[model samples]
Target: MNRRTLLTGLASLPVLPLFSGFTLAADSPLSAQPPTRLAHPPSYWRDKVSAEAWKVLFEEATERPGSSPLDQFYEPGNYLCAACYLPLFRSEDKYDSGTGWPSFTQPIEGALGTKLDFRLLWPRTEYHCARCGGHQGHVFNDGPAPLGKRWCNNGVALRFVPADQPLPPLRG
Candidate 1:
């Protein structure tokens, strides 16, 4: 289908509300109630992201490998969902796997998730937003140890937040 047709179809889909890190007992960053309502997507969001972006950010579509700006953005910053701004990964957690995507050794504690992705039609592990349920990427056991988890994220799926903002208060 054409890009606009694809985006329009996605925009009509409900935004599956997800919770933040602290809400879940295991710190699932994507735990809000699934979107049960459907409406036209917000104008700002529609304007901010392109139709292609909407597909990846909202529809969980993965881009062809080695084609995302985020895959090369190795700056020290926070990688957040471009759609919801929920913190997903930190620079320190990133690793170079030459997977043509930005690979993280870990996510922001609870900012990721995994499920069976049949896209490749091989039951690969699919990972995504713990909050908005946006598709980030996948995970693989073939990673450096200590965490031994590979969080492969799509470039357009994230917006990097430099460590400019003051840290939030500890949640004790």
Candidate 2:
């Protein structure tokens, strides 16, 4: 099938809903409700993150594949938005897709928002942090069963907090 045909087929599939019984540990960064949206402008994050990270988070630039250490990282932790420190994904949902990026089957419920991107001359679902609106990455249909989602994320746009470490407070 052509790329467009494949994407169209994927788009027609039903998205799995978040589990009603799923719960994070009391100490985990995520809460049952969606994260509170931040009002800060993209410029507000200018000084908080490195230049490369700022590019990915605010400018919506994609990092080189296989360049992110997070792709190989399999530690138990939560991935937070590098721009605003909002928890975006849990370790349990992460997996290696051999795509050279940190891929997840799904994100923390309500942690991200999506929009259609056409920068590559085709439609793709681009997701960003729901709280800070920092661009994370594109979501594809080629993933493991149950969800069939591949949340291919930019490592520069995320900060991994090992389970042993307390999640940092949300930043502007």
Candidate 3:
């Protein structure tokens, strides 16, 4: 089954503490990344996306990429959190992995946390945001060269920032 279906099926069952393992160390490169920060919650996307998206990003749930338009976003743009517009993944870091959802080789340092996901029977690794703790997607060993990592993300949980604009400094 696809990752989303697996996630849904897993949700129907009780969660084990061990199911949430696979933490990247605080000093991990991803942990050193930056993102847009807000003192309060977002008003725009709070009312923009469907209820499911709200449940996923805001509530730290997962959204299936098949249901999210973001899966097809190959344009050069930044990926922001749908619920908060926090810049997460940039288009430059993205590449076509033919993995159904948006895929990236890198994220801004310190923006994401990696953990082990057992939802698929196999011990797969997953990553999410540090600030929002929203489910982004899984990391597979089978990816393009150099980095050799694929960060598969749920499109519904992300927003696109066109490459034409300069990204703001990540919040400290």
Candidate 4:
């Protein structure tokens, strides 16, 4: 290699640790982490969900606002993670956040996990179903009283269970 190229790479070696250290921190046990659960192969999930649901749950793609029928759906029910059928939010917590997605004030205790999302160059609290590690949505500070937290969810990632219907038992 040229002398110039060799020297340039050597100069960058010091900076590499700064970025690699960030990755190590993420893997640290002290980090706020989701509980470990039974894992399935990607093919198993692909066979279970729709193309749209797959994009949102597995690929972390957001669905269009106001596009989900669940946005207008206010019937008494429980909202569940479509991937693992884990009950996440209750019908009583649902509200119109004007963001078009199904907004909730909170989730069932330990039903979800969170991480900081820097996708838009700003950090947002992104949450996922704890049972299956499926992407659900982000939680924001602006919302109704009592919690003032808006759990902005992608409707495609949820399955609504009517109040009269029984939800499937949570998976261990």
In order, candidate lDDTs are 0.65, 0.82, 0.65, 0.76
Model 3: worst 10 consecutive residues (lDDT sum): 13-22
**Of 2 and 4, which scores higher on TM-score?**
2
Model 1 Cα lDDT, one tens digit per residue, 90-117: 8888878888998987777656655655
lDDT by residue for model 3 (1-172), tens:
7999967876775432331333553423455334433444533446666777767655556665466566666778788766545677877778877767778887767666666666759566677666555667777767777777788887777777788877654432
What ranking emerges by TM-score with the best candidate at the front? 2, 4, 1, 3
Off by over 4 Å in 4: 1-36, 169-172
CA shift of 44, model 1, Å = 9.4
RMSDs, each prediction? 10.1, 6.5, 7.4, 8.6
lDDT of 4 by residue, 1-172 (tens): 6878867755553331221112112211223443455476445688788889988887889999999999989999899999889888899989999999999887776577666666874456677777677888888889898767888999999999999998887643
- In model 3, the Cα lDDT at residue 12 comes to 72
Clashing pairs in 3: 21-116, 22-115, 22-116, 30-110, 31-110, 32-109, 32-110, 33-109, 33-110
Candidate 1 ranges beyond 4 A from true positions:
1-48, 166-172
- Candidate 4 residue-wise lDDT at 98: 95
If both were scored by TM-score, which would come out higher, candidate 1 or candidate 2? 2
For 1-172, candidate 2 gives per-residue lDDT tens digits of 6988968976884453333212222222334666666778889999999999999998999999999999999999999999888888999999999999999988887687766676875667777887888899988889998878888999999999999999998886
